[model samples]
Target: MADISFAGQVAIVTGAGNGLGRDYALELARRGAKVVVNDLGGSGSGVGASATAAAAVVDEIRAAGGEAVANTSSVASREGGASVVNSALEAWGRVDILISNAGFLRNGRFEDLTDEQIDPILDVHLKAAFYVGQPAYRAMRANGYGRMLFTGSASAMFGHAWQTNYAAGKGAMLGLSNVIALEGSAYGIQSNVLLPTANSRLAAEMDQGFMEIPAFAQALQNADFSTSDGRVVPEFNTPLALYLVSKDCTATHGVYSSNSGRYARVRICAAEGWVAPRGATPPSIEDIASHFDQISELGDFSEPMTVYDEFTAVAKAARKQGVYP
Candidate 1:
């Protein structure tokens, strides 16, 4: 394969002060992208802000002979989102890619989770993507070229005991990305979700039991082993992110899991499921229970291309049963 480059392109990477976001900003800059490194420099719970975190990344990129600018704006609000993208516009004249990687964690069991805990997670993880992506997406649509990658998480897909709020927040990103993928395709804008397994501050704060699951635990430990020093560095996940948001990447409407040099696509598909004959009167509870096995069979699965596709399937089945007038 040829070398991938972002020459002449402009990108905005949120939460770039440190960890995965920092790595992504640096790599994009290294590949000739003019990057806007946006970070609020807050703790893992999304409190406080500072310029140091973003400025340091900007300095690192410049020192390495790459182009970058720092934007110390929170992505959780509409104004902050606009300001971040505005910074990119002022510096680069246009925006080509948006990597929404800003996030934080406030872990709590489902029962103990409060509205305060839930609201911030939703604001930062879910709503922030909307805020930032909206303006950038509009620009991309106008220019007829754009790439968007929203950071999701395995905790959302697979579930985590103490991260109910966080999982819900990340799950919203998946839905948001899917809609963007569908709507943006006509305009050359591709949107996808990233379920990254990096050793960021959020990972460090996770309950040990949450980390002990055999499948994920092994990956986490492997990342730990590869670090030269004892520090848990999130740079391990940058390469895949860089590729996903690059000009050469046209793959969209997809989800990917990246960590420890392992990358794979994740999909959301529904089973075809059993269908009752139309006009057959609603089935009894007993009848549904009896046909549960047929309804649950994975072999009957089909990937619906759109919301209408699902409805069309039902209509087709009804017509097939001679029930449509």
Candidate 2:
């Protein structure tokens, strides 16, 4: 296979000052993209800000003969999100790629999650996709080429305790990316979600409290997860993310996980469940209880692209079972 290149592409990476975002920005720049490194430089919990982190990344990129510019805009707000995109347009004239990776974690039990914890996370991880994506999407539509990567999380897909807010925010990325993929298809654009686990400040934050559960912690320990200068690091996620946002990517509306050097696709599939008989009366609670095991069976399944697709799958299954005869 030939080398994948981003030659002449203009890219925007949010939270590019550190962790996975920083790795993405640097690698994209190295691969010939003119990158906008936007970071509010806030702490792991989303408090405070500084411009230095972003500037330093930009400096590193330039020093390595790659092109980059720094933008210190908070992506959690409408104006701020647009400002990040505008910086790219103002500097490079177009945006061909976007990596919506800006986020922070506020860990808490579901019942104990606060307004302070919930609101900012949703603003940053979920709403920021809309704020930055719309404008960049428009540009890509006009240009007839674009790629988008939204950062999701394993916590949302699988399960994690004391991270309801974080999971909610990340889980929304799957829906957001899926719709964008369908909408952008006609315009030569594609969107995908990345559920990545790497050793970074973000992982460090998770270790502080989120990883305390023995089963969860033991699983990770057995996975041989390491930190700081270890093999399982942020740069491991960079390649997959860059690929998803590259012109060579043929997939859209896809969810993929990259964890500790393991890469795999994640899916949301529905089982071919029990269908009610064609009659005026709905099935009773007792009837449902009896057929619950059949309804829960996963041996036969369909991955639906939309709600209509889901219904279509059920219709076919019903026909096969003589319910639609």
Candidate 3:
């Protein structure tokens, strides 16, 4: 296959100061994108800020003959998100790509999760994707072309104890991206989510050593599981993210996971559940309970991509089961 390039494309990457975001910004710049490296230069806990973090990345990009500008706006507020995008608009006049990757950890168990922990995370990781993407999306819609990507996490899709706040924030981005993919489709734009596990500060500090908590540890160990920390390397996670954010990406509304060298789609599907008979009285709790196994079985399921697809699946099932007759 020929090399994929972002030549002449104007892109924005949030939290580009370090870790996976830095890797993404540098690589995108290297591949010929005019990048806006947006970083508040905050700590892993999201408690402080500096301009040097973003400036340094921009410097590296320029040193390597790539184009980049620094933006130190936080991604937790609408104004902050727009300011970051404004840097791109101010420099290049258009935005062709967006990678919503800005975030910091605020870990806590469900019981301990507080408004203080929850609000900022939701603001940064979830709402901010919309804050930035909405403006960039409008630009793409006018230009009639765009590619948007979200930096999601495995912790949300799967589970890690003491990380409800972090997980909730990351999980919501997938929902946001899915809607963007649908809405952007008619405008020649695409959106996707990336659940990447890399050896970054966030990954290392995940769950606050929750794995050592024996009950959770024993339950998470699957019988078929055979893996090591080899997958935590960040370099291995960048390729898929880059591909999905490039112009050549034809796929949209996809949730993909990349750890080490393993790359795969993470799917959400509905089982072929029991359907109530036509004209039958509303099923009672006892009746529903009796069919619990059938309702939960994944022997046959549909991965609906849109709201319409859900109805289509139901119609198809009705026809197959002779319910329409």
Candidate 4:
């Protein structure tokens, strides 16, 4: 196989001061990408900021004979998000790759969570994608090439206590990436989501008891989320993330997971649910209860790419029962 390269490509990695984002920036720079390492230099809880973290990473890249610049811009705000992209543009003239990896954890019981915990999570994880992504998308559309990767989490798919705010933000990345894939198809742009589980300060701070429930516990046991020393380090996830945002990759509208050493595609499939009768009167509660098994069954399923595709699947199922022409 030919080696992958990002020569002449300009990349932006948010939260590159530490953890997974740091790994991403370093690797992209090694592969010949001119990277803008954007990090707010705040704590894991999104408290304060500094330019030191980003600057240090930039220095590392330059020391290694790679090109990179530091941009300490908060992605949680509209202006800050645009500034992130602008840094890449001003330095290298265009954005060919974007890794939306900036975020922090604010955990609490759903009912006990306050606006402080919830609002910032939304701003950084969900709204930041829109703010930073819009400008990057425009640049990619104009240049006729781009690769976008949205950082997501397994907590969003599987339940995690005290992470309602975090999960809510991570889960929305799938929808955002999917739409971008569809819209950017004609322009040679690919967008994808990465659900990564790695050991970092954020991981260390998580309450181990949060996964005490049988279901969550079982998920942890089933996945070998550890390295030789029993630590799932960030390097385990960097390879997959790098590929997804590389010019060689052709995947789009895809959600993939990198947990421990495991890599897999995370799909959202619609079941061939039971269709009620097409008569004048609608089905009653008793009718629904009777067909509950079939409705919940996953023996047959389809992965719909868009709303129209999902509706078409339902229409097909209805037609099979002679409920539609």
lDDT of 3 by residue, 122-169 (tens): 888989998998999988999999999998888899877888888888
Candidate 4 stretches greater than 4 Å from native? 208-231, 279-281, 322-325
**TM-scores for every predicted model:** 0.89, 0.94, 0.94, 0.94
lDDT of 4 by residue, 55-85 (tens): 9999999999999999998998889989999
CA displacement after TM-score superposition, residue 42 of candidate 3 (Å) = 0.7
TM-score of 1: 0.89
lDDT (10s digit) by residue, model 1, range 63-159: 9999999999889999999999999888878999999999999887677789889999999998899899999998889889999999999889876
lDDT of each: 0.85, 0.91, 0.88, 0.91
Error of 2 at 271 (Å): 0.3
Model 3 segments more than 4 A misplaced: 207-215, 219-230
Clash number for each model:
0, 0, 1, 0
Tell me which of candidates 3 and 4 scores higher on lDDT: 4
